[model samples]
Target: MTKIPRGTIAIEEAVLNPDGISWMAESATLFNTGADPKKASSHGHTPQLLDIHESRLAKMDAHSVEYMLLSLTSPGAQGEPNREKARKLAADANDWLAAEVAKNPARFGAFAAVSMHNAEDAVFEAQRAVKQLGMFGIMLNDYQVVGEGGDAEGKKYYDAAEFDPFWKAVEELGVPVYLHPRYPQTKDLERGTRYGDRKQILGAAVQFHLDLSMHIYAICSSGVFDRYPGVQVVCGHLGEGIPFNLWRADHWYNKPVKKATRPSKEDYSYYFTHNVSITTSGNFNTAGLKFCIDQIGAERCLYSIDYPYDTIEEAQDWWKGVDLPADQKEAIGRGNAIKLFKLPLEL
Candidate 1:
């Protein structure tokens, strides 16, 4: 086992249980690639996605990851169209994760997956996960389809007024809501054809970030923070490039003539600083890391491997050599997560 650095915590890792839902089994058919995701093809190191035992814990230990906050992979319960089925699948997945965390409470933390198809159930499950199952937070994959799957109008977002109760419960519970990304709906994906060449060029790489950025931007601009300032949100991949364009976004949207559409009274950067946190997940560029830190400060940054998609070794290797003060690196590498998630860490 690689000697873990004395106090490192890795958030943004993922766990997959095929038994909880049919999504995994049918992913091959649903995905354009038609390759079985169960076997893993080209999406990165996926074996760990299914292993909640020796393989996962061993990897964490080997790479010096003291603790891991695990969430379900993309489109988990979120993609299931049937409200009843989604709820059951979410509960099963969370229960499974709770059992996994029980195996080594000190080493694993769980982020609960909830069904947003039914907002009431969303709140209920989140409360149950944190209060009863001991999950640290919730992972909501971008959007959800309400009554039926295919209709574009059926899509619902957290920034919508209907989700206020869900956000309320999140704030009252005091756990972060991690906004993870999934591919856009089929209709939305079809619309991407306007930028066909570029869409084909970057494929899911660029589009995933763009799709997720829309949701993040909605939350930031929705003034959800004004009402529920206690709610915390976390997004991966260096704030989905929001940090770099923060000034431009706020300036354009807040222009006197355009200000009418500005949902929040505060500047966009305000929420970015106060209510949002970013993680170094999937993207390993040191320059990007430096920029994110300079933009958001080390206190709001956390280290994550995007495991199964990113390796623990890659994150450790890069993180160990991050060009910053030891204290600052420590803050991003582990301390921030410990503080944000309220992990038991003796400073």
Candidate 2:
């Protein structure tokens, strides 16, 4: 392994609970609150920061990560039942993030939050975040749950025709749309769960990748990729299981179904090559990273820490020793993110 530079960029470092203790209460669950009977007491507040500033610098230094692109945590605007409330929270979160980045422009940047309940609001916020706040892109928490109608049984996806406006805005602004995963709806959440409550959170850690991967497939098969060719979509955790099973996914497309409207060349691999990007977050396996780079190409892979859950030190310790070409490692660590987000490379 080649020596990584002293201060490389880790684009996927997250900034959760911007309102601090208040925001934590809103998103906290029993399992993640460190109240579970299974874990040790020392696991309390795994990524505790004295405050936001201390947290930011500490993790950055620990990982030798010079730049971090902050994002709102899981169940961000996606959990809001009311569109109006969701929109407000989205704006407030973006504003807070922008201000935080502004304090240390070189060291920090952010992905804007959006309320996917309303397509119009999602578009508006995307434009505002990029044009005004100078956000790198938009971070959406998996599928948006709007009323009782927006669950998995409802089959409501953001890539549908009705959500074209959101895609249009993203493409127009020339910013990437990161598809971050949330826990799946109740019906589809059983596969990865082991026990009861423990299963929910643990299942999330594992299954979110699968959920987002399926969403990517749905979008592509539904012709969303063909329609919005200019827009770039990124997924965390090594394309969220897509690369590992891509061959199988493509095999499914080969079996003749009914009349397929999309072009013959518009296969799963086409979307993988043309539209998608991946990040190495909690996944630290060297072989997996190398395999992903081989399958998807190094240009589409980015480095991330999945901070708060996976620490910067652990991530760096693993990443710094991964066996790959020097150029590929550098690209995964920083170059790809810079090119993808059009981030300023002053430093």
Candidate 3:
């Protein structure tokens, strides 16, 4: 087995605030037909999610993770229905996360949570989070679920033209927006038709990536990356399975008819490989890791634990046992994230 490297970084690790603790529970109701508020709030990972100090650090130390980039557990500010309230929650969560990172800057960094309810507000909060709060990156919890009660207008994906300013702000701030997955019950009819009985497949099992990749692919196909080529986007769970299937999609898009209708200037793979970086967050299979490296290269892959949701030790152990070259491993474990995020750390 390979030994642990020093100062390895884990992006996509989750943290929460006491005031905003109920957001996850509320999210389950919005997106999970089977969500029990009690069970969702009191899930086994609750302690880890709220901890910013000793316990989390101990886990990192034991598992050889030198630092973590934390964000609010999903479906965060993005899932909130009330637009004004969502904006406030985003500001509050980012502020709290900043304070947490201040407690131990060496062992922790954080991503800013922004409400996608209104593109204007999202732009404002994202700028403040990066400039004032000192967050390393921004997090958007998939598509923003907009509207109140059953009147929801459905998801507002960032790929829309109105969000060009938000993308511009991120590019100017020079921070990657970590697009994380959320539960898939965004629509009752869709949930009932497909993932209805099998609740297990709806969350992280299958639906999370299935739903998220649509939005990611939307951004790839929507000319956002082409418009703002400086903007970088990070996705977890092995590019939400994009790396595995990207070649086929890119192959199909070569059709003159398809190309004529599409908005992007380059192939899907072009935006994907150039603008996107994926992390080894929850999907810890060594073969999957190798396959992803073959598709996207190790420089675009970052090592991450997806902490609290997935055990830290398991992810670390998987990395230790991966059959990859040492330099590649070094890049994935530390160098890539260090350079991409411009992390101020020494390994």
Best by lDDT: 3
Best by TM-score: 3
Query: Tens-digit lDDT track for model 1 on 1-347?
Result: 44335756878888887573445544332334445546743333345688877887787777788888989988788877778988998999999889988987878889999999867999999999999998999999889866664563367788889889998999999999999887544444445464432435222367778878998999888889988999999999888878989889988988997687677878778888899999988888899988888877888888888887777888888888878888888888888888899986555
Residue 311 C-alpha lDDT in model 3: 88
The residue-by-residue lDDT of candidate 2 on 1-347, one tens digit each, is 43334466776666655453443443343336345444433323434521347866876766688788888876677866677978988898898888878877777788999988767999999889999999999998788876654243333577678898888788889999888877544444344544334454443466676567777777767777667789899888888888998887777786677225444347777787888898998888788988888887998899988776678888888887888888988888888888999987642
Note each model's CA RMSD in angstroms: 3.2, 4.6, 3.2
TM-score of 2: 0.86
Better of 2 and 3 by lDDT: 3
Model 1, residue 187: distance off in Å is 4.5
Compared to the true structure, candidate 1 yields what TM-score? 0.90
Q: Rank the candidates by TM-score, best first.
A: 3, 1, 2
Task: Please give the lDDT score at residue 224 for candidate 2.
Answer: 70
Where is model 3 more than 4 Å wrong at Cα? 1-5, 27-41, 185-191
TM-score against native, each model: 0.90, 0.86, 0.93
1-347 per-residue lDDT for model 3 (tens digits): 43434857899899888876665555544344466756665445566788979888887888788889999998888778789889888888888889988988877888999998777999899889989989889989898878876655577988999999999888899999999998753454354566655665667768889989999999999999878899999999999999999889898886899899899988878877799999989999888888888887788899998888788889888888888898998899998998898888764
Error of 2 at 32 (Å): 3.8
Candidate 1 clashing pairs, residues 3+ apart or interchain: 4-64
